[model samples]
Target: MTPETSDNRTLPWFARPAARTWRCPPAPAAVRDFHASLPDYAPTPLIELPVIADELGVGRLFVKDESSRLGLPAFKALGVSWAVHRVLAERPESGDGAAPGPVTLVTATDGNHGRAVARTARRLGLRAHVFVAEGVHPRASAAIAAERAEVTLVAGSYDMAVRRAAEAAAAPGVVLVQDTAWPGYERIPGRIVEGYSTLCAEIDEQLAAADAGPPGLVAVPVGVGSLAQAVVTHCRSRAAGPSASALLSVEPRAASCVLDSLLHGEPVSVTTGETTMAGLNCGTPSSLAWPHLRDGLDAAVAVTDADSDRAAADLTALGLSPGPCGAASLAGVRAALGGEGADGRRATLGLGPDSTVVLLSTEGSEANPVRVTGT
Candidate 1:
């Protein structure tokens, strides 16, 4: 595929820092404390990529690998498990703060989040009801069912499933644990964003242990922008550098809600339909996260299906079996660093030879099996 030229591009947004402090509302310390208490909780690897770093002409490239977080194939467990705990832990009949009741957790997903919610519900002796769009990845659907949750297939896209799940959550004892936020429904999605902060915290500690400073830039795959919010919150609040890290929000070209919203200066629904990167297939930015992302991010990049598919193969060669969604950040890096507007974007965003870059490899190769081989 030819490189996307600026004249014909629907990609890349270079942002100026907001006049206000670029911070999200603080997450509860209890979420992090709860995640730490889990037996399976462990920090995923922060792999240094000398080869890609050299090619990208950067000082260093570090990937926060999230393929195996809390025994799940993707990083969704960090948010899902923590949100589940926060919801249950607040209940009066939490059984001496040990056993939760026969509640049901409901949510919609392209794949990983639903499975994570289901697994988290099971761990707490609660039932789960997961909703997915009709065309979700087959393996993801099967995996959600494997967690013993009742899976309902919706007729349209991920957003439609989200609406359906919201409808289903009206039943008594059923709680909607969604990642995207809407009007009057910001609390749980806010908690979900908070849960994701654990990864950013772990990345900070790991970098410090290696005597490395904070990365100059962080490129994250944006679905509804929850993970990006976490990264921004951590980097802004505790950055060792004089300034916050330059944030690049990456999304599927077909479903560039964050990019579209930023351009319009408000939330706008994207109608390009789904792309291959299922997890990043969101059509609208989360209400809770749009403010942080709109002000704090340095740029936004949209990559094509081919771009992410190729990135998945390249990451696999580097010993990380990233699925298409996971590798979108890498693809964004390529597009941002090598395309026609590369020099302009770099200079505009403060990325130079002295810069260190971090990419969030969000999941393993579960969404695309044909292009992936080994673990």
Candidate 2:
């Protein structure tokens, strides 16, 4: 089939060639080494979308499938678990890294991050107290609880939940292992970004195997932008050229922090806009994640819930299990492929046949197995 194509009349804002300045400082050497040893930090897998790639006029489309990441079923497990483990290891004097003690490992979550922290705490014998918004998926809360963490569902938006988590983090015994940073809390967020670096290392190997080589266009979903930061920083530092043309950050139109920051050259917060992909409904990018996205990422796009739903269905059709939030990059990729796409319902984001496209299927349905269709 001769794939039809559309060009964007309004070009995406290009982020300058920002070099990554993240410091891999010596903080928790033992834990960092332990995280490195988990052997589980492999690149998962990357698959092709032959029909969609061809239909959209792209040379090849690849998805770094996170549906089965670490057998826990999402990429959040990578960062969360690593952070929780490191936190526990750093405070060894806190006794057996197991059992609920006075000290609580606290953080707010849209879903996946909490599960990762909770899972890591339970695995290593530590206590966890995860704060979440009331409307967060019951399954996500339950998953955290399963790890023996006390899950507190706060009322209001994700920002409210985060504020509450921050308050709790101030308790003398509570250590905040947050995915997003504010004020003095930056270590946990940095760990989240560092942990995410493992994903890129895996993608490199996966891309090499397919012979489609490295991707030219990579569409990564951005919540607080930590994941996008990790992917863009690693990819730009390692791969570039025709095979790596652009690093695209896709956000829910309602909460496009990365796009707004890239456009204004500053971290500006937005009101929490509604979206079915709750995990990506963040209004502000992580302070730690901001610099990387602004400097390393090439462009940003906002996708709608309808776009994400269609993407979810398409991935399911491909026999790939994905949640609404998980399949989001596909939604952006589809939009970029079509002309005047930023305005249409069925628009797409695509590139030439030789322009290998990579979509980061960042999360999985396990967080919220069934999606509530959103407008």
Candidate 3:
């Protein structure tokens, strides 16, 4: 079906045939093992919201609460820690007897990813230089600085900040550890995406423990699509069988790069605007992630900031402290399963009253304060 568009945004929902031909190597078992080796490592909660399931008309709803992974308010630590560890471990040894100077990790962020990179650097006795876009909350930049990393405020959008970070990383002894990937810059981002598999692995075990069968739908919030890439890779792996879970990509309506790209059948850069879901306010899809998302995603939806705010409030009322980005899964799900032609859309995506759903609440309230505008 052709997607209806207005104001350069695709309408609330779009679905396509789930691709079975896209194959990927299983994420290494060592990724989870490495995370388990971390001092703060523990499986985050897989919270069941039966009330929400009843409301949304699904059998069961589980939210993978990544609010406090590794002591960070967001799940980004899983990827950043593993990626930094791999990069440092693979660094070539000094040829001469002289010792090497301290390595400085550099990257761009809207909020959480930069802090994760900075925290990794601090733990390794290295330096970090984080670049952030203009209008980033002072508190977000301050949080990165609290890690002892030097923070630079770029006078442009997140994409511009990414470019600036790349330029700085060109200098000797600096490494760019961005989660988003372009053509020649995919290896590290691939590792970052691999690191995110730890979250999915935990979800599998947790679902078993809860006696919940395989998920029928898995909803993820996309920034540059790294996390969604990881989710698609994990859910579409050979082990998930032919009846793999349907994947949904959610993004801020004003910055719905992945949704726009999926609708356009290509990687399309968007002109993003400010949104309460700041972490997902990305303009471009990661080149490494685009192909996986293109083939593996079963649906894509974009939510307004107001939609996310209400979802956040609802999650809070349900006793979960999800930030706007984290709460966006609910918004997307609501959009897809409610409103006009809901029955047809649900049928297209194979949703039913008995279908189990999993939402990746990728961050906590500490990352971004939720502002519910209604009484």
Candidate 4:
């Protein structure tokens, strides 16, 4: 129950399709208002990555560096803050408003999301009760605690912690603010997904400033499928070339829920396996995110263990120290490009040099290296 010392995570927010923006227009008006009220929050820059471009033979490769976004080193804060904010704004009758006070926001985390929730809750004068599956990364756990959240490690897996969070949220007054959505509990997570559109909006503005347009492709890491859909929807919404943007949802080969879901056109749980990419180890896709992805995403791919580690190392080379799960988008790109035993996966996905690609280094490697080296 100790605090997470540093947690001000990042996110790819405000992605919309050409027709409209707002993933959940029906979402709490206050949530929409909060997004509309960000005067001080500027868009993150889209850094052109020569190294990645040259390797993939792409004309250009861009990175939306979440690590640098708001300096939280991960994209979790966007969802956490938005979700908590919505929950508090909804329960106006409660004393102390959105402040955590006696009631706490609860959720499970394999990595950044818990820390994000904690960070947001603390900032709003609220408390967070974070549940982590057994063996959650020590640094990730430390980060959550650093935010002054109560970190609870359950005996089972991330799913188990999620179950506990749901149960806790069911009680009166306490809120279960989570990123992954389940049945009848779609609004909060959907708001989190909506928050990611801001990332897309920023990328568009940055590209406009450079006198260029949107990228041809955007690779997204799929945790519960929210991020992938969020980014894809935003990038494609704009009027653009023939194939506006192609999304490649990357998952751990072992725990490839979105991949399996895409392949089957229905959600399914893959048995969990050992992988260093804890955040990307989700076994199922969010039903809320499923439809958007099924209709919009171009393809889905699972990355190998070597791909994950090599990507971590490669990101370090990119001057972006990314945690295993965070660097997964770049890792999958490298694999698809045949850079790391992925000669066919790239061609199979129809990727080539002419394409402009964007990757989100979702986290910083303050912990992944130590975990990887230990293994």
RMSD of each: 4.1, 5.6, 3.2, 8.5
- Model 2, 200-304: lDDT tens per residue? 766766778777666667788888888876776666665444344467788887777778777887899988766888888888778887866766776677777
Question: What order do you get sorting by lDDT, best first?
Answer: 3, 1, 2, 4
CA-lDDT, candidates in order: 0.82, 0.72, 0.88, 0.69
Backbone clashes in candidate 2 total: 16
Candidate 2 stretches with Cα past 4 Å from truth are 1-36, 39-43, 92-103, 239-245, 341-351, 369-375
Better by TM-score, candidate 3 or 1: 3
**Which segments of model 3 are wrong by more than 4 Å?**
4-10, 97-100, 239-242, 370-375
For model 2, the run of ten residues with the poorest summed lDDT = 341-350
- Across 1-375, the per-residue lDDT of candidate 4 in tens digits comes to 111111131111111132122232222334334655654354565778788799788877887777644446677776666766666656555374544336678888777788778877777787789998666667778878998999887877667788988887777657888788878989888889777776766677777776656676778888888887677566555544445566677888778887777666578888777778887767778888887777667666677677778887876786777788777888766655553334444444445667678887777766333332221
CA deviation > 4 Å runs, candidate 4: 1-42, 92-102, 339-352, 367-375
Give candidate 1 misplaced runs (Cα > 4 Å): 1-14, 17-26, 93-101, 239-242, 367-375
What TM-score does structure 2 among the candidates reach? 0.84
- Tens digits of per-residue lDDT for model 3, 1-375: 466443455465667775644667778889999999999899999999999999999999999998998989999999999998899878877888455657899999988999999999999899999998776778888899999999998888889999999999999899999999999999999999999999999999999998997898999999999999999899777544346788888999889999888878899999998788989989999999999999888888998988899999999999999999999999888887877666777776778899999999999999865322210
Give the local distance difference test score of model 4. 0.69
Candidate closer to the true structure by lDDT (higher is better), 3 or 4: 3
Q: Residues 22-119, candidate 1, lDDT per residue (tens digit)?
A: 55445566767778999999889999888888889898889989889999988999998887777776867655765644688999998889989998
Clashes of each: 0, 16, 0, 29
- Number of the predicted model whose TM-score against the real structure is largest: 3
